[model samples]
Target: MAVISNSLQIKHGLSLWCPQSASINRTHRRSSIGLGRVLRRSYVAASSAFANENREFVIVGGGNAAGYAARTFVEHGMADGRLCIVSKEAYAPYERPALTKAYLFPLDKKPARLPGFHTCVGSGGERQTADWYKEKGIEMFYEDPVTSIDIEKQTLTTNSGKQLKYGSLIIATGCTASRFPEKIGGNLPGVHYIRDVADANLLVSSLERAWKVVIVGGGYIGMEVAAAAVGWKLDTTIIFPENHLLQRLFTPSLSRRYEELYQENGVKFLKGASIKNLEAGSDGRVTAVKLEDGSNIEADTVIIGIGAKPAVSPFESVGLNTSVGGIQVDGQFRTSIPGIFAVGDVAAFPLKMYDRIARVEHVDHARRSAQHCIKALLSAQTHTYDYLPYFYSRVFEYEGSPRKIWWQFFGDNVGETIEIGDFDPKIATFWIESGKLKGVLVESGSTEDFQLLPKLARSQPFVDKAKLQNASSVEEALDIARASLTS
Candidate 1:
């Protein structure tokens, strides 16, 4: 039997066909091998594409916003991909506010140190272990700093030269403490800024050995730190350039209230003061701080809780617009850059009620913002981030007396704050606006009032201001508020 073969070739303007015999078998074998190689390449390409398709949602920063975002996404069934959270810190995301208060207290009082099963404990116990993220199928890259973002290419490059592609990206980068320049001895071993768990730990360690601690900045952070230090029986003094604490955020009267709280707890206040120079010992530990008033205060440790600047460098590098030291996002938490969203302390969002853009660093804000972002991501709906801001700080006493609690609320169009339950000038005050309950200032009078404030704030149609103030007891006031809201 004779085998027949045909060779066909086509050129620019010509075609040729030749019939052959012996070469046909060899040609057929080569063609089969070539086809197999093409198929294999296609299969491998498809596999690569599949792997890329399964790439997780990438979130920068492992703070409250990032953790809340991860949890929200998982709860909404949007936790596909790897849900990678890259944090510069080695530990998982922990409660930051608690760091300055509870964590600084004795082990028994610190929530993180409590041994029993607590609902607040994430996948692992406190201290933000990675297992929490792992439990939610989230991947964490700790101690990894994202250096640059390639927006056009949808890629991020780390400082270590690693590149990651993201299907969706969230810039919850949070913020960093505003440090004084090294020339002013800001970088000294004894000078510390509180922004993370590590900083708190360092401060705690320093407090152990120090006899006197001077905290610069009379903002909430500094005041909270002072309260914590004083609670631990340390001689602590707070230096505030302003006449009051949280002057930037609250009215003079409110700030004065905070000042009084700290003072009552045996924390010294140096208002309208500045640090002239940090006197150091031979061992490089801060021995004292020279004040601008020509008076030198002995300071074993100096904590600078001056303020914070948004951690928006990565987003800025990607050409995402920012304002008020935070990434500007639209109603849906979508940044000016497409495929990117931001939230928490690092996101400047429009406040319809206040008719301005506001950025709050409270945990509630972080949680609500993350929830809004997650809802938007899942439903593809456009919802404005318009939750009212609320925050609280724990006040501890130097003596054996009970720790006082202070809380504030800011409202718009709400009317007349009502005072109830003895209206102790040193304890608590309720702010009622427009016949509606608005703000509650609590020191030690009622825990119920503190808990009820947030609920009423959200429920709107707040408590009956008249009835609340006229009520004989906190329980009566709460019942009136609940009834008013329901009615």
Candidate 2:
């Protein structure tokens, strides 16, 4: 709530808002030892008098990871005035994925709203609202983000000039949405970017009055917004530098299928486009998008969804994984500093299943890593973090569409791809390397079919490309992949 001159502008909850592939770096694995000895120091340490009140567990972010971490602490019988959450937003942590998904749906669709989509609920757990934290004895510091973190002394100072020390610290500060420099009208009134509930609220206000919507990225944010814009009956156009959408994940064929679907729903596309600058009207709001090719698209609202990077400014002195763009942590989410931990998009931890260090930007990793970190901290879990990359989205429900526009992908999207299905009722894409299934993506899959991808991808089953490609339906193809795990 207090604005200060000496504070880092590290945005919170951006990952849970955007939840896209911001940056992914695969590196050598790491080893962790002596965690128990270090964490046993407790809140009553040598520097106990540094702060008026020291919490045993202080989570620096109130995003999905922070909210879930609080729930995990309460579940483990640890929330007896020993846990606290410091957040940059006035509201407590809620499910951020809704900002682009159900939150953007047409008003008639009864889109998701606050108090109903808080953390843990996104993962089928209990909803932990603001009052829930009070009921469970968890301290809440809303709208006060920690600006400075002292790793050696194990203390952090908030922007409101509040000093707090922690026995065990969680640096869950998620990410910040990437934006254009203000020289190019990036700061124009109608040129918007969504990274939290506040950002979404402003965008919703713009949408209510806008006649045309211009989305300036092909990734998750642009695609999802495009779908929502069409639903609202606005003139929607998606412009991106890539030849196809979701360039990071979708195969050419896979991208084509979704592009066709979007086209059928009245969304326009200007693929492989480069933006020169945003043109502002006399009223000082974004009015048009100028392209490098001497073309201009008139627009009343612009949504920027280029990408995001980890919000790790306050803790950079603690030796982060610079190559991976986040705080470096071991499998147990322990930073180089003994009593500190990092989770969610900000922690570049070892992905044991892949034998490489990766910083995953997704809700699933956020929920699982928070629970795993707390368990490891409480001495209930011993194993390292073994995570398989998973991403999924469901968009578009127009007047005549009965088919569910949904897809789930598991594992890495490397290696040669095999695009299957008829695209009429189903579409499946498999990534194969050395005749083994490395990843699987399927649209309009069944409940049973969706369950097989994680299993098949983790096992990396040796598969026959011909057998999989020739399978009749999504169920049949996934059935073949499921069998290959044992064969």
Specify the highest-lDDT model's number.
2
**What is the model-wide C-alpha lDDT for candidate 2?**
0.79
Question: Distance (Å) between predicted and true CA of 363, model 2?
Answer: 0.1
Q: Which stretches of candidate 2 lie over 4 Å from their true place?
A: 1-42, 45-51, 397-403
Q: What TM-score against the true fold does each predicted structure earn?
A: 0.77, 0.90
Please report how far candidate 1 places residue 279 from its true position, in Å.
Answer: 2.4
- The lDDT values for all models are 0.63, 0.79
TM-score, model 1 to reference: 0.77
Candidate 1: tens digits of C-alpha lDDT, residues 114-221: 222221243342433466567667777888989888665567778777677675688888778888788767877878888776787787788777778889987667
Q: How much is the lDDT of residue 405 in candidate 1?
A: 61
Q: Candidate 1, overall lDDT? A: 0.63
Give each model's clash number.
Answer: 11, 0
